[model samples]
Target: MEFQATLGQIVTAVIGAGLQLRYLEEYPEPFWRPGDLSAAAWRGRLPNAFALVASRPG
Candidate 1:
């Protein structure tokens, strides 16, 4: 959300670059501790970050 690009835009750009998307997943918890108590507790909410797996064309 912070970035100007949307998730769909990013995926499209990656695909356009000749990389195939293998997997995409959202994290359940913050990778790092946040100052907010809710985020620090990782209360099973929607993730703020995500994991994307892409591979170059074979």
Candidate 2:
């Protein structure tokens, strides 16, 4: 599959929607590496997955 927007774009959109960024983690490879079942083997790959937590103001 192809990505329409980038990480920065997604973050910007979230901020624009009035949500505050709390945590952000980027995985250097697909979170579920189909080929490499071991973490050590996939540790040095390029990032393709993102994990983030955002919240709205009280």
> Which candidate tops TM-score?
2
lDDT for each residue of candidate 1 in 1-58, tens digit (9 for 90 to 100) = 4757767898999999999999998777667765666653378676656789999987
**Alpha-carbon lDDT of model 1:** 0.78
lDDT of 2: 0.82
Candidate 1 lDDT score at position 41 = 39
Query: What count of clashes does model 1 give?
Result: 0
Give the Cα lDDT of each candidate: 0.78, 0.82
TM-score of each: 0.60, 0.68
For candidate 1, the per-residue lDDT at 3 reads 55
Strongest candidate by lDDT: 2
